[model samples]
Target chain A: MIRLERKFASLKENSKKALVAYLVAGDPDISTTLELMHQFVLSGVDIIELGVPFTDPIAEGPIIQAAHDRALQANTSLDMIFSLVEEFRSKDSETPVILMGYINTFLANSKALESIHERGTDAVLIVDVPGESSLEDIGIQNKNIASISLISPTTDNDRIQKICMSSSGFIYYVTLRGVTGASNLNEDEIQKNILNIRNSTNLPVLAGFGIKTASDARALSQISDGVVIGSVLVEMIQELSEKKDYKKIYNYLNEISAAINP
Target chain B: MDNLRDLPNSDGFFGNYGGKFVPETLMFALKELEDTYDQLKSDPDFLKQIDQDLCHFVGRPSPLYFADRLTKHYDGPNIWLKREDLNHTGAHKINNTVGQILLAKAMGKKRIIAETGAGQHGVATATVAARLGLECHIYMGAADVQRQSLNVYRIKLLGAEVHAVDSGTATLKDALNEAMRDWVTNIDDTYYIIGSVTGPHPYPMIVRDFNSIVGRELRDQSIEHFNAFPEAIIACVGGGSNAMGIFYPFVSDPEVQLIGVEAAGSGIETGKHAAPLNDGHPGILHGAKSYLMQDENGQVIDTHSVSAGLDYPGVGPEHSNLKDSGRAIYLAVNDKEALDAFHMVTRLEGIMPALETAHAFAALDHLSGKFNKKDNIVINVSGRGDKDINTVATMDGISLD
Candidate 1:
């Protein structure tokens, strides 16, 4: 089994939920981002999702969009992200690292993608490509790296089945009917949709999008196997980037992790 | 080439371009739109309503005026203008907006959203939304909001809210990004009325079909007025709606040549232009696969053009296929050349062409010797220059204020 499968299996064996933390690569700077990765792991993050910045992040809200802008301004590239993952692997190889980005950026760096498995990356979630389009459909074929798929509140039952069947790592259930950082969390709707997804596939379902607080993560984790936090942590990173305040971020991650685990 | 109009396939690929490269939240919406459009495209009541609006409301059948002075100045083909400048809202944008708003009404959407560059499309969409009594919102780049303030006021006067998008390059692409985000957020009752022949799947097809009225009218008008088909058809391509509007009907006509003019802001060599077909490679932007002005890192770079409408990093997917297949010839003209054409056409033809349309007129300077004196050369004057006076005056170092 791959790293993601093993990680999820271990979590299920322990009867615990997973906590995924997302940060943009090269945001602020490269060395700081690498340090943040180590810090995230130390803070009890089960999975690391590194955002590969693109010029137009249409799916993201203002906060994450600003993060992408800062990352691009720092000249982050696919090679640098891969190397970051490789360096992270040197210290801690247990946790799975997923690269989340737009389609064009991955398509532009197909060579780097072909070697991602060797470079310690586990999965990829391209926001624009969606479930109907496999990476292979767009002329990208890598059997090693798991292809993650998203199921939104707008996704119908038929598309949900299709998306779930093709997805590998885990089913990402968008908690609300909005972009990242949108605050409206209809927990009832999220629970219903996640249940609908679980009926179709046995893969672990993780709720993401609009998940901000530890309470939100804990509530979502009850209905699903895990929860992915993105925009809020990215916002905090930007706020504390100048001061290099990793301890505060680590504490916040620890609080969220403890909330989800119990 | 045989089934040129039957392109974009069931999967929305014009050969190798065009597809749904959007987030998962928008997929069902795109599919729903495609299904709805397929049902209503040939419905008699829908067709009748669209026809009634085109004839009565929009004042369709805009005259095909022969520009005698412009022809004489070029000393080549007889220059004829397909006067889309005379359409409702002062541009051809209403042709697509009217059809889309009707679709929105049929779909029971209570809100309408759109993105604009020069604000002509925003005004057109707002006009239809006001007519239909639907809530309307227009997203425009902050830079373009300042450059096209006249049309901005026109859109607001039509009772639509205008949102100045101050993100990215603060241009059309950024406006499109914000519009997509809004649509994803409010997918239940909101209908996004895409202005150009761009975006994912059904949008390019729907916009092309609605705007295809231009070519359908031109076909009969050319034979009626000239007694023969024009030797060439020329139009300016921003996201390529106007050019595609005229080129679709004549794609199978072996005798007639199709020409698309792209905006070269300074020069393509200067690396500050929007001539994607001329100087770009195949990539994806705003949900469609097309020729894009992007860096090696796959990041879309900023594009430049005096005409705000044409300052985009990518062209429509069909245009990319056309360029690859040699079905249409693409050319580019610089800002200085377009500015010169702006003055020349206003003086010689007594018609002030939009800065975007001036790019098409400038192509005559390059194709001057290609046609005989008797050959008819039809050009799509896509919009009027009333909105561009401020920019032109500022270029001459004079402030209208």
Candidate 2:
């Protein structure tokens, strides 16, 4: 089984919430990116989403795109990403690392998702793949590397059911109708979407997008099983990578994880 | 995952180029298009609709005519012309436009908007929309309106609202700017049917796929009629859809020489040209990175040519890819050479080709130095020359008579 499922099942046993940290792979270099992934888990990151770099990433915020651009400029390939995941397993195998990226890069890189079943990667979140066309249909729904899903404010009720039914991992509930980092929380809408998603499936619903502040994470924690922060973590990388140290990113995510718990 | 030619990721693009790139909000929609277009490409109903539309409406299998007089002028082997102008709306634009209108209707979109240079794109869009019963709007420059009044009337009569753009230069580029704004704002209900095989990602792939029929037909027809493939396949390159449509299939055939002729305006050495592949550097235009005519600061430089259709600052990414691979060769033809061919085609074969076609004809003359007269070359005569009558009349310093 994927580490995410093991972690979620353990969360039910321990009666605790999970903390997910998202980072763009190859932001600085393969070595530094690998170092950052280890630090994320050390800082109590329950789950990790390593963003695959793409030439054109429209869905990502400026900070995330900049990170992807840097990674792409360094000529980082999918082989390097899978190797990073495998390395993550050498030290600690408890935390899950989901490979998240645009469909083009995913199709360009991954020969067969099943081939990487034991590569230590947990799940795929192809941002451009539809709910109706799930990972199971494409022969990639192996228990070791299932597919996570993103539910937007624009997704209709029928499609939400389709997504919840097709999705294998915890559902990521997008908080707004705009791009990443474009909007803050709409409490009522988030609660309503969560309630609707809750009625559809037993999957743990994590709220992401625009959870930039500590207080935002705390508030979202009150309503969901986990809070996912991507752009904020990437923003830290952008700020600290200028000074040649990504340890600041580890500290920043730790702060958000602390806020959600308290 | 099926055939490389299969739908959804046809030409290897999802939503045709409008794939997921940004925030989570837009990701699902683009994915829907990606998944839908792929499956739809092979669906029996989808294939039937597209085939029926092309056969009865847009018209299919444009003729392969032997340009005996023009071929004899070059004093070469037999040169044949694929008559895309014989299609319902005239030009190869209808082939893709019709397919997209069907796709738009299938996608449940209600309105259609198109951008035009010299009104050919507008005419093509309006023709498809009228046949499909979809609401249509066309953005054309005020300058193009004055030049192509008949075309404007043709589109308007087909039940489309023509928005005369008064923007900078008031030409095709400005018209496209307005059309993009409309698409961005009303994307929920509108489908922007791009004219050429340029733009970001999927547009290059989609427009090229739609236009590739020209090449597919030519490939078979050349074999059926001549019993062998021609030595060269040539076409004019604007955003390079027609050229790419006819050139892409033959690119893999090493024996078949593929050439794209660019509008060299006065002369390439003079610095005023729309010869992007011939002169431009790699840069961004309409989103995707490709060969572009830009200045030192990377600002897009305005281009000039006798044909309004060819005056663009960039070529498609696939062309850039093709150029890098050396699978194809590009050449530039000046105004004078194109004009001379313009008169030659008119006098010899009674075919008044668009100024764009004149450039392809000029390429045949230019390559006479490279290949022997025995080497057969085929030119894609994209459109009729009626739109250029006034421009051609004022130039050459002579009357129509």
Candidate 3:
């Protein structure tokens, strides 16, 4: 089993909800991202979602898009990100690292899957590639990293079943129809969808997209396995980086962690 | 070619290219569109309606005129112009828009959304939506909206709402991103009319089927005029709608050569051009696996061209497949070459061609004496030059009042 499954199993045993924190790999610079990864784990982040910055992140709103641009401007590439993951893995191997980005980045690298495993990545979530396409179809599934799939509110029951069966890592449920950083999350609708997905698979379903506040994460954790925070964390990284204040990031994540953990 | 026509193979892939590389929220919408198009394509009544609209509404069989002056200038092969520029709305865009609007109406969609680069497709879609009495929204990049102000006004004048996208290079790709977000939000009632032969499966197929009338007409017109098929067919390829339209019917004809011209702004060596097939590698962008202008990290690079319509980082997946299979030849024409062709065609033929189409005409200089005297070469004049008049004048250091 991949590190994601192991982490989730442990979380279930401890009766704790997973606190996932997302950070763009090369935001501002690679060293900052490296420091933030260690800081994220230190602040009780159960899962670290590392975003490989892409030029066209259609699913993201302005905040994350700007983050990606900043990362790209810093000359962050997949190889650089993999090296960061390798460095991070040398110190802390317990936290699961999931590399999330558009499909083209992965496809561009010939040994992407092998390098992913070599760098000690636990999982990968390609935002643009739907469930209809499998990692095996692209000739890269045996690298031991879990290929995660997304389940959205617009996903029909039949597709939900298909995606759940094919999905290896935790299923990411988009809480809203809009892109990342969009508002208007409905707890009831998310709960119903999570229930529908849970019926199809034993894998954990984590709600993401538009989960801003601790209350929002707390409300979502009541109905689902966990809540994955993205835009809010990414925004905080941008703000804190400008002030050269890394303590605020740690403090902010600690607050979110405490809210979800309790 | 007979078997090639039955491609995408239920998985929406065209030979390792062209798959549904979109968010999960849009999968149902794509599947719905595929099912609807599959059912409607074979319906005789629906086919007849589309045919009638092509003939009466959009003016089908846009002439295959012999470019006497251009041929004399080339002094090599006899040249012919497939006059798609004469279509209603002044471009080949109306052909695809008319078909998609009919499809949207048949599917009971109440609203239409589209993304535009130079605003040609936006105007075409808005015109059709207005004709069909449906709510229309067009997403155009803020930069494009500024560059193509006339087309922006044209879209608004057709009673469609224009959303200026201000993210990610502020160009066609960004506009497409915004459109996709809107479709995901309002998939139930809104139908997205993709401008070109790119995007997720069924979309490429649907757009190709709708626009293939250009090649079908060329096949008949060629026989009538020259008593044989033209030795070569050329069209500009930005996302490859016009090129695909002219190349599809000729795919099986081994004797007829299909050439796609791509924009090379400044030059391909400068790393500032939109010639994906020439300078790019195979990668996925804009929902399809195709040759894209991207960096080593797979991030799509910003593309440049004198024509706003051709300034896209990716080409249609079918074009990529064709390029790989050696069935079609792809070439690049720099800004200077294309601009020269644009002026030459206008002066010689007395017909102003769109900047995108000028790329096709520019390829003639590259061919120089390659064809026999009797060999005929047909170029698809994909659009009129009116939208580009101001841009051209400004480039020529002349103020257009």
Compared with the true structure, all predictions reach lDDT values of 0.92, 0.77, 0.90
Between candidates 1 and 2, the one scoring higher on lDDT is: 1
Residues B13-66, model 3: lDDT tens digits: 778789888988889889889989989989999999989999999998899999
Q: How do all models score by TM-score? A: 0.99, 0.61, 0.97
Q: Which stretches in model 1 have alpha-carbon errors above 4 Å?
A: none
Model 1, position B164: C-alpha lDDT score: 98
Between candidates 1 and 3, name the one with more favorable DockQ. 1
Model 1 — TM-score against the truth? 0.99
User: Which candidate's TM-score is highest?
Assistant: 1
DockQ-best of 2 and 3:
3
Model 2 TM-score, all chains together: 0.61
Q: Which segments of model 3 are wrong by more than 4 Å? A: none
* B-chain TM-score for every candidate: 0.99, 0.91, 0.99
lDDT per residue for candidate 1 within B268-299, as digits (tens), equals: 99999999999998998899999999999899
Model 2 docking category: incorrect
Put down candidate 2 lDDT per residue, A39-64, tens digits, no spaces. Answer: 88888789888988764454565567
